[model samples]
Target chain A: MKNINLLAMLSLLAILWSCGDDDDAKPAEFGTFQVYFDNKVGADDITRRDNGSTEYDFETSTGEKFNLSLLGYYVSKITLEGPNGEYFQDEMKASASEAKGYYHVLEGESASQNIKLEQVPAGTYNKITFAIGVEEDGVLEGAAGGVLDPADGAWFWNWNAGYIGFALEGTAENSGQEYVDWGGGRETLENTFAIHIGGWKDVADNENFINNIKTITLDFGTTVKVGPDLSPLAHLVTDAMKVLDGAAIDFSNTFSVHAPKAGKPFAEQLPQVFSVHHVHQSTSGHD
Target chain B: MISKTKKYLVYGWVLFLFWSCSDDDAASPKDIYAFEKPAHFPDATYTFENNPITKEGFELGKKLFFDPILSRDKSVSCNNCHQQSRAFADSPLHPTSIGVDNRVGIRNAPPLANLAFMQEFFWDGGVTHLDFVPINAIESDVEMDETLVNVVKKLNEHDEYPLLFEKAFGVKEITSPFMLHAISQFTAMMVSAGSRYDKYVLEGTALSNEEMAGMKLFEKKCATCHSGELFSDFSYRNNGLNDSFGDLGRGRITEDEADHGKFRVPSLRNAELTAPYMHNARFLTLEEVLDHYDGGMVDSPTLDPLFKDGDQVVGISLTTEEKTSIIAFIKTLTDRDFIAEPKFRNND
Candidate 1:
């Protein structure tokens, strides 16, 4: 009877210790986080025009007028970081059927602009990092579904065998493109320009190939609390003028950039194009 | 002197053992469909995990390969340029590809074999994966002249393709990746490793005296570029084919002046059957190709250094006897079984 009493006392002490450990460190809570991309040209919002429309909405520093028919970029590898070593990385995987952790943010598509990340560990995040183009891992995974599928409107390069990371297609006032009726259902516009920034080869000994994928990190300037009750939204502004004006583009000669070497100058200015506009900590969900 | 019942029991036991051994060795269903890597080959580079080879998937890919519905007006198919009779290369009648609407292709249609072991495709090595190679042919204006989206729509509308796709991939809706993956499953299994040269290397089969002499000459004169068991090292080098770049070759892909006039070194497996060689089909026979290496090379800034000796432009010095022997050895690389395999033929 005395030995049984001693065993019962030890079991009671074990239960008390477990309860004390739970009280000291409660379970981590998770909430939603959203990132909004706002595309702009200089100080005005992007106004997408027709493919061959000549009415220019933007002018370069060299006084070359151009109007965009399509403006978009591939965003991937999103991450949230905090000052206190709190971090969250979005999951990335590609298979024959689906491609996860990739977003094709296009102009005039409001639904595509908002990127929602869920199950983030509750913390105070102050910085956001993302990639502007599909990296080598994304392209090396062979044919994929969702946003990376070419049949489903992925900006893919068939000859070079890679995805166009960033695309700017429009009409320029002094473009060198000429109209060609190829006797089929295909024809080139008279003054249209197409700038496709692609190429993902990074050979160790070869310097001829160009890899134009760029990653950008921005500071929110203020921290926002994230928890089960609080959902945070980060507003980011992407300025296209940094690509054209910063590169000192002359549309007469610099209009067509379909190759990697031709697109290097525009891709070099991508790091400075994105910046954080504001941060909102709200009880309601993202709008 | 043995009893009749005892004799029957012994015969039945012997027959049962014989049947079981043969089934395990040859008649097993799994063994026929499996992608068996040849013992002499290097590891395959295909992403088989993304799309494992199933019997149904292979069948679907073969049907698609033979179907001309992939073209714009159903005028051509992959089989038009790639014929199984010529080891999946074009016949000698058409040096380059003769595509839809009688459009003449700029480059020669290369042979397809040992594709799972390859890292890149095309003469310029632009495509890096086997799955993405078909998109170029299907969308090239001189080739299929059909859009990828339209091809998918046509397949969906076909009465038989939808059910075949469902059986292969277990999907309600047909997609490009699945289609590409199915094609890869068929192409990757086209492993060419049963040649006479393969037997000579693997099973110690003796070559003729002439073939042996040619192989020795080949090792000395050509092994710098065509080094490994696969014959070619898969490098892009301008073999002094032209001085002025009409096609621009690899330079168009890299946009680098140094890479001008460069094309991929093709594998010599089954080279005897795949005639009219080179990226532009410059040579009509193996003898002509060897002659080009000896003296016909023109001078160019980007010519392969193998053809140069301190700017003297000294091509490979091969005598007539050596060239004859090398040709004999090269013919041994042709695998008769691969081209004549009934399973690789179109069923429908």
Candidate 2:
């Protein structure tokens, strides 16, 4: 009777150990989500022109003819939300060598437009939110690397000591920019316009200080599942016309906008500029 | 349970003995290269965790500081404007900074010392971070006239710099942040806390009778703006510099009409060596600066209220004797040890 009881006890212990092993076999599910920024001027696709290009490819709401030579904006602090309280916040870190969350989506850079976020918990996310510009937190990190490195084509304003949030450089037909010799092989051509929007400092006591960093949120219009087997890509459209029209920019008068107060209107229009064009749940590979 | 409690007490006692031994080792002294805060001074404002100071990094920064390679034409460097002999301030000959191609800067290059404590940089307080400060000088048309992209490229192409950078930051390729970090490591180590006033505060060293009297008067009158151990409240004030604004000064940065002609209250440390004072290098001597305070001030809309007594703009009521005493006191702030420190010298 004693021998039979010992055998039964040993069998029960083995069964429990196997059950624990079975639970450990399956890990928590995580996946990747791709955010594709499709930049456009109204309904037409954007084709970047040279700095001195006279051929105006786009027209504003006010019927002002212009062509983009350079255009870009920084995006950071991305978050995805679901209807059933599922939330995923992208990690933010600014070290000497890396600025993790900040993304400089520039025109003509095809690889820079596609932002791939990895290690996202498997869930059905319906809404996406992100800041249009590098905010106070990004600036206060002192020195940063990757896209935030000013040495490597980062649009940084030296005197003001902040990154240019959004930049639109082009030649407008009605631009009043006079030709000037900057010396040392640098020149500002006639009819050329450059609008650089920056300044994150917003002191509480100082009312005049402008914080032009803007946040934008867009609904997917349809829920997309994210898992190891399925990866969702959100296609967002950025319309430059919305900013030019919404701000009611007169190309002649409002040509050079490099300051924070001057860029307030342009930054304010950032929310309406970005929209969810479409989303795709691809089984494999990044587009 | 009683035996377990007794065992924990015995373990704690042994650990305490080891901790005490380690504490004694730490108390003996720190390395000369290591950044140590003077007990009298406030905590450093620099973010050390991001770029911790190493011997190699500090040396690289020092090399960069004195190198003319940062300039567009390789004709100017930080040392060209900020010399060590003048306490890292520009020479009195150059009222404002004389940059590359003999191009003159508008504002005076203020002395560089105890920068780790400063919250802002430049006369207008435009730059909030010390790392960002060099970029202004490098990119300024009147100064270096070199773009940061070009500077990084130049450094990368150099034979020794790439390897030096690797040793300093442990990176295979050179980047701007690492370069900036290396510079910060050197500048942050420039802690000028060995002045006579500091010694008097920390070690109870005696000051001359005149200096003591000046100290008392300064505490009574000037301490409102230039307060604390580091000196200067770091507030922006017009100080009745001018009636009209040529350079908007602080207003240019803030875009506020009220901030016109307001510049940061500069620290008085090494004030004796740093001649041609104020934002525009208006005052030639310490006596002239005191004279400006004693009725030579030009009134402005944004003039500091401290200088104003109702409708009458009364600058500080300082007699000639009082001025002499204040100058004597201010001279005590000159740190000979800091200027003569051989480690800061450019060996190459």
Candidate 3:
């Protein structure tokens, strides 16, 4: 009877200790975080697509005027970072059979106006980072479904065997290639400058070309405080002018970069296009 | 019925045990199907990091290489263009590489030897990676002309291939990267460093006075471009085959006018067997190739600087004696052991 009373007293103390620990260390809550990529030609947001009848003028950092027809590129492997090293990663990945992380922020897809990142660990996230294109492993995996799916068209160079990670179709009279007219009243200038920068495979003994993985990281600078009461919305502005800003190859004359040698200049400057313009934060984590 | 089922299970377990033991039965795992990298040869550029070359993977790769199932119509195989007899080059039957639907290839199919040291592939050097070379051929309109997805689907559907793939890679469903890697393992293992010339260099083997003279002649005239231990520096240069471009060659890939008419420097190893020579199979024989270097070179702006001595022609100077001796020396590069390697032959 003396031993039994002692055991009972110990068990009661254990339950009290567990309850005290739960009240002291309450688990943090999490919610969905939305990231929006807003495209712009200078200060003006691209709102109009004037079929072939009208061409929108885009002025580069070099102050050279060119007309753009289509402007969209893939952004993949999105990662979110907290100041205190709190980490949350997405499990889904894009492949030749299925598209998971592949997001093509198209011109008029307000339907997917923002990429919804679900169940982000509830905390103050200072930055967002993502790869500009898919790495070589994804490129060599052949065809995939969704945004990476070639059935969507104009992304893959079938004969050459590579995915065009960053594609910008436009027209310049001085651009030293033939004009591409995609009917719908869509007509580029006499010369079309198609910048398709992508290559993650080596060609033997060619020192003057890019034969390795090309992935540029875009880190959002603005601080975002996310919690259960607040799922922060980060606005990222990507400008096409930044791609050719102080670029090695003058896009004015030698514009079209289909191969690695020509595409290296633009691939180097891919990060300049992205920046976090604003962030919405809420106060709920600290209690 | 239970006794009969028990007997079958015992038999099945025995077979599985036997099958598993065979792979491990070899002397050392690495030595089972060892890759040859000669002392004088440069380090292999194609690193098998994720895809280690194994006996089963190499065998599966060889099977896939020789198998016609990878082709669209089941008529064309990698072996069709890349024949083992001609040193993994085009057979004499194919003047130029012929593909499915009897389609004509643009350039002459080059030989496959010492590819581990090679950085780029193709006459135009369009393909940077050796593993990617098969994809180009498989997808080309005139070649196999099948989608990579379709090829994967077909391979996965096959009864034997999935098991072979499982044996090579643990995955039940095969992927394109594994396919490319397995094939690369087979291609990379094809080392031609055991030639008589190689033995002569390393072991100081006896050579005839004619071959010795030819070696001297080759060093004096041809060694600059085909300099390395592999006999080719693996560079793309315009050897000035023509004043006007029939095919833009490297220019087609690079899109630079300066690169026009340039072709990859073909390795002279086993040159006696691989003919006709040049990108377009322009030369019917090595004698013709020597003759072209001797006199037939046409002046073009994109011509290699080695060919031009300030607007004056600097073609290879060779006499009848020199040519014969050079041919003799070149013949010594034909590695008999590599061609006769029993493991590379069709198992079936």
| Per-prediction TM-score to the true structure, in the order listed | 0.90, 0.91, 0.71
Candidate 3 runs further than 4 Å off: A1-131, A134-162, A168-195, A199-221, A225-272, A280-287, B1-30
- Candidate 1 regions with alpha-carbon error over 4 angstroms: A1-28, A283-287, B1-30
**Pairwise DockQ winner, candidates 1 and 3:** 1
Residue B45 in model 2: lDDT: 89
TM-score ranking from best to worst?
A: 2, 1, 3
> How displaced is residue B63 in candidate 3, in Å?
1.7
Instruction: State which candidate has the highest TM-score.
Output: 2
| Predicted structure 2: lDDT | 0.88
Candidate 1: the clashing residue pairs are none
Candidate 2: where are CA atoms >4 Å away? Answer: A1-27, A283-287, B1-28
lDDT of 3: 0.73
TM-score of 1: 0.90
Q: Lowest-scoring 10 consecutive residues by lDDT in candidate 1 chain A?
A: A18-27
Q: If both were scored by DockQ, which would come out higher, candidate 2 or candidate 3?
A: 2
- Lowest lDDT block of 10, candidate 1 chain B: B17-26
What is residue A70's positional error in candidate 2, in angstroms? 1.5
Q: On residues A56-165, what C-alpha lDDT tens digit does candidate 3 reach at each position? A: 47666665656666677777777788878866665555443356776777656664447877778777787777776666655544334567654344365544556677
Q: Report the lDDT of model 3 for residue A173.
A: 42
DockQ of candidate 2 is 0.36
